[model samples]
Target chain A: MIGTEIPVLAVLCGDRRPPDMDAVEAAAEIRYTDEKGLPDALRGADALFVYDFLSTAVPGAWHAADRIRWVHIASAGVDPVMFPELRESDVVLTNSRGVFDDSIAEYVLGVVIAFAKDLPRSLELQRQRRWQHRESERVAGRRALVVGTGPIGRAIARLLRAAGLDVSGMGRRARGEDPDFGTVHASADLVRVAAGFDYVIAVAPLTDETKGMFDAAAFAAMKPSARFVNVGRGELVVTDELVTALRAGEIAGAALDVFDTEPLPVDHPLWTLDNVVISPHMSGDFVGWRNTLVEVFADNFARWRDGRPLRNVVDKQLGYVPSGH
Target chain B: MIGTEIPVLAVLCGDRRPPDMDAVEAAAEIRYTDEKGLPDALRGADALFVYDFLSTAVPGAWHAADRIRWVHIASAGVDPVMFPELRESDVVLTNSRGVFDDSIAEYVLGVVIAFAKDLPRSLELQRQRRWQHRESERVAGRRALVVGTGPIGRAIARLLRAAGLDVSGMGRRARGEDPDFGTVHASADLVRVAAGFDYVIAVAPLTDETKGMFDAAAFAAMKPSARFVNVGRGELVVTDELVTALRAGEIAGAALDVFDTEPLPVDHPLWTLDNVVISPHMSGDFVGWRNTLVEVFADNFARWRDGRPLRNVVDKQLGYVPSGH
Candidate 1:
């Protein structure tokens, strides 16, 4: 038997219809609010789901509220929201970790194919009305190193292997398991392993150890023909080092889906590079992405109401450490 | 112990290189002829390998030689050179099959991902400096039907399955078993099975039965959201019907690697449509492709000289059917 007395739930964001809300509640409605409306919404709320990126923009009175028992962020990564107040609070924090796995994985594969098959060249030729038939490289039988073992990383690895690539993954702590994937390597071994791979993908979380991880030294260690893809936090890679690597031909190319600054400036040198493929951090934004977020929140809500451990619970000490550590 | 006397072989095309010529001459040295220099080169030839696209245009004297006991085509499909004179002779005919499998398979996957993720739209937005994020469909759990069971078709099927799609292949004759693939359907069942698939790929060879196989009726039977891909032969699909299908929204989109006429006439209406992605029949072309062809030819040469059955031998009755079927 389920409880009929629903706790007050506050949603922080614009009124984009949350996915699976009908299945989540018949009469258990959630109170929606913007940043200005947050204090009122959180007055008596027991749980909060933050969908607005502005929630962490300013320290709000809601953070001091003692009634809030759990906070759910409708994003795969919570690095931006990890403040000392939220980190030190007794409130449990959960993220939409699994939501973006497949979509982002698809994006990685799409970019890889685009580069390998010379789609950009084809597009350029099409504009000129030229019928050029050129041989392109094959994705098959190439070795790849995925430098993160989270859901998104694993998904990319799976898709790459399916395309006949030799895919290995790296984690914070290598367990030597993962039978479906190649040998799991430790982060310390990345530089040594990177040279043998044709592709190196960075999907690691933004941590003290991972920040600026792909620096000049790392790029210098990769093969000249290898490609680098970074879908993780932007700060995880050193932009200047990446530019140097590309300019010096240390790596063949690089694809960035995130940047140190949001809405990358038009004058940025990244847009000028022929080899770099820049995306506006939209890899995880798919047709039903909002619905997926709602579903995740609903599932977590049910777990919280039943006094069960919340799913995708963020490690406060590690500051957004993924589960299955 | 082997014979000390090397057999003299004539190559119809003069573009033979190391790996390819080496492959052909593993058992015997091959003397090649330019189309303009054919008579001199074919004088004392014991075997001939035809690599020219204009083989049918060759002078009558080259085909009349009784000393030429074997003939091999460098291309996969041998319909262009299948004259009644060549078919009736004791001359052995072989083809370069399985050489282009990985490249074509990579191309198919590339185009499929491009369509699924709206890469064209993304690129357009990138050019316009717009950061519009939209939902995209995932390739996982979707169904794909490859309408040909040849090496190219099977390779496409393998690659798609690896990307986590449910793939079914239809061949000219259903052998009922393919260890590398699943659910090999006969050609007659294609129309009935068309509706259930999310992707339809035409990879069948060009034949009397397969010519114009993808007509209005086939398009009508397909789901409105399904995407069609053709990499087999241009003649296998009715291009007019495809244009109509895209216009009427009978299908979501289509990517064509081959067309009824190549360099697909600039005035063709298909180019005007936003949903169509056209490639110049170059899906199988990739770096090192020429070398792969040479290896295939060389391997078959050893069997030919040892008085053993050659690989990829065409069955004249079935029009380029692989022998031993």
Candidate 2:
């Protein structure tokens, strides 16, 4: 525990940071800054709250983070903060895990239904005022393979099953029986398992083992009629292979929210693909999410002040919580 | 029942009709025709199976339908066959009920999620090759008012509820406690209830009381952020009023699958409206729906042969069956 002489907490924020963090303010002395001002702000701070998880500010400012003992990221994925130095350091790591579970589940379900109902074609016709009746596919009783056993993946599995899709989950291994997903398969089965499901959703975290996990082989193994959705890290998939597969009609379609390069360039082929659906990574951000982030940080701040074990502590070496540990 | 001699059934077909309606063919001596040859095809028919419900040929050949005892429409909406002469005739009108229920429900849930997830905006951004992050709304626990209590409406309600929407159904009357919808409200309460919900969906059959039900006054009652979805007959809503409501932002957006005049016309203002989604009156045409319609007709045909009361017998005056009578 740090000296209780009003412990200093450095908060990293963007322009649209949460308006009020009263619980955090009441518990600690705070300093906030964007990337430009981060190094100076990190001076004398015992704790760090990464409110801007997407910012490249962390690495640049890490050398000056001498007093930091506990680093909390307001994001489910700890990839941005798991640097080599931090992983080997004494600083504890925590993340916002449960926050985005339900919101992202809604996103996956939306994309699934959108594809099943031929909504893209409908919207295209709507643009031309063309009243062309077309037959759509049914979603119920269809098979779905969600390749992540985390809370977000489980939430999606539960909701998809409730909405009548036959859902199966895959994780690092078949880690005992899960109430939501019967038995999660190892990542090795992903390529082989691709053909059986109509919808293959990717929500796995980013790591050496998972990076570019869905490549040419996996796409080739999928049924020609199947669709893919990626709400996880952009690096989890090989964009070139996916593009080749889509162009060659190896798979029916793809709904890609996260991309290998965010702000996917104007010249990117994905922008013009007829069968691809793209969204700038906003699936987990529901209305008032900023406020929720603040609440999560504040709660953790209260725990830190009381010298209690922090919530959502990450198993730094594994790259994520064994379960948002 | 008619004479034991194989009953002559005139099957109305369009250019793209369901292939091999073997069930109907095996049960009855079927004669087929498009609009041009309908009159000659109906010359000796004991029963008329209006498979091409969209064809205007029914009205044109109604005067020559002297021997027609029963006119079975392969559709849920009987409006196409409910001509002035047919309404006054002794022909038994039966529809393909129960087939479209779940399919249309899937469509509704799709659009609902699309709106909540701001998927339209996402697609628009993708088209512009812009990566802009935006927060979306949660579909779970959001209230929805479904303005129909028929099978199609009930199916939508059930699916929406499963997808986590707080759903309520409104029927022509509160007939009884429905297992799926519980105590449904009267259609008269639609306007009053509209203000309380985030989504207002219309799936009612076309009838005198329902025609122009959703007009200026009804639109005014809806929340500013509310979205309207119409999967029912086009005439059930006043298109002009809907357009006006959309322009003024009386409601957030609309997903109109049916229109009073379809192929909604190239010069229609709705085509240019950014907040509207339109599909050509096909919310429930699943991949094998045509085959299912044939199976429904074949099943009803077998019952008719045994001299049993036909299922989905529409109440001539009311325009629809009372719970598939």
Candidate 3:
């Protein structure tokens, strides 16, 4: 029954559409729709491709996804599409996980270096045409705690260690002798273990247990000279606590690519803080990333059509693509 | 001759005096003076310590150095003290060279990553409270041409390679299968070979042969997307040509730590350019760098007192501590 009839793939797109989708188009009948048209498009589709990974319309229109046997999102995190109805169903869920690993890893390393070298201050001084000299901190030999042990977090750990940083990881369970991260501390011990790192990078997925993991206590555990970087989901941190921590000098700086509310309001205090470096949630996006995202989904679609084991299959219970998959 | 009469050490200071000089003060009869008092202080001194490495008054006071046997500068480059008399005389010249290697290497990597990740732009947008998402480039697998084969350049090569860049070297002579840089291109071929790299980092010392090495021709030879970084002396670049190249878009961007002039005038055109990142000539100066510089000089002073070979003796004619020393 897998290939007996051509499967319909409902492609959910926002203002921007995925590029290089010829292969996906050829393999399945593609139904393109915006959020408003998603329900109609998904009425009898065998699969749903959430090209607009940022949209939260899926949960509201879940009733129309009755025939959706498989769902693929063009993003690493499944938070946007992990609706309760879908989680309870037998439908398979996959993501574009490995595609963003190295790219985000490079971004993490870049921000870490930026904070260490005081590059933001240099650029600001450059803008003022000032020639003031200041001593900068060295990135090498600094301790960094990567708060996720997934492929993306592992990639970051590898790159940071390569740049001479002592790297450790935070995961579901404490373990030793990990490949990329020498020691993996349990996520439950985040508050306790966070004190030892000069840089605490949050790359954990958003789940019931992980949401608001980086609160006032976590920031308090960090050294006043420590920096925080978040390339993970925004809700993984408490925004108010981070703001207070930064304002009171509990932490030295922060480089945030994601926010609880993106395009973070114009009057938001984080914009005015000299220590906070904010980007519009594009850490993993390299040139031609859209093409890569489409390719990942297309390759996965081919596998599904052939009744083969899908890549990056998310364990609904874990809320992510579990380890050793 | 060896620690027999307790050598008279003249320490040349500017507004800031060297800190933690207790050892040097105890080891010899120390005479501290500013530029104006330098000539009188050097009249009977057996050795001179150029604590203020930026001063050009050494040549003006060279006549008073009749009893001087050695001069140690607190800088990697000996450009300020490479006067004709010093180069022609039997006087030994030593510089603080190795101390800056890893620190400057980290700075070079930081700027490279800053450019690759568009961090400067992110900071600018953050200032304006704009959340625009842009695709950035990857640093890994990118080709880099380190235009100096000295310790600093070698350190940069090693660190960049660790960060996954394919690094080559530029030196006085071309060679293959080098240790840090796999391939070394001759400085003479910079204009021709500059086209092959994404980044060209100039860490060469200021010498007659290397002066103005990165001129208009070199800029024209590079890709329009290439970025130039200078952690070397300012005279190594033709400033006017660099300004023209930057304005005409011959090259994409430049991160200049050194310039033809210190405290680059208030209304310089380079400061107005959006593509240029200007920093004071302090890339190698890290936290506690002054202490390290002083320690280097103290250790060299001990070797001089013992009549043993100095650690960083500069080849006066070559203008730098040459490789294999």
RMSD of each: 3.2, 1.8, 0.9
DockQ computed for model 1 against the true two-chain complex using alpha carbons: 0.56
Query: What DockQ was computed for model 3?
Result: 0.83
Query: Each prediction's DockQ?
Result: 0.56, 0.82, 0.83
Give lDDT per model, in order. 0.78, 0.87, 0.92
Ranking by TM-score: 3, 2, 1
Question: Lowest summed-lDDT stretch of 10 residues in model 1 chain B?
Answer: B53-62
Across A78-153, the per-residue lDDT of candidate 3 in tens digits comes to 9998878999999999999988899899998888988877889989998988889999888889999999999999
Model 3 per-residue lDDT at A219: 96
After TM-score superposition, what is the CA distance of residue B174 in candidate 1 from its true location, in Å?
5.4
Q: Residue A269 CA error for candidate 2 (Å)?
A: 1.7
Candidate 2 C-alpha error for residue B23, in Å:
4.1
Q: Which model scores highest in TM-score?
A: 3
- The predicted structure with the larger lDDT, 1 or 3, is 3
True contacts kept of 3: 0.78
**For each prediction, how big is the interface RMSD?**
1.6, 0.9, 0.9
- Candidate 2: residue B41 Cα off by (Å): 2.7
Local accuracy of candidate 3 as per-residue lDDT tens digits, B17-121? 899899888889999999999999999899999999989899999999989989999999999999899899999999998989998898899889888889889
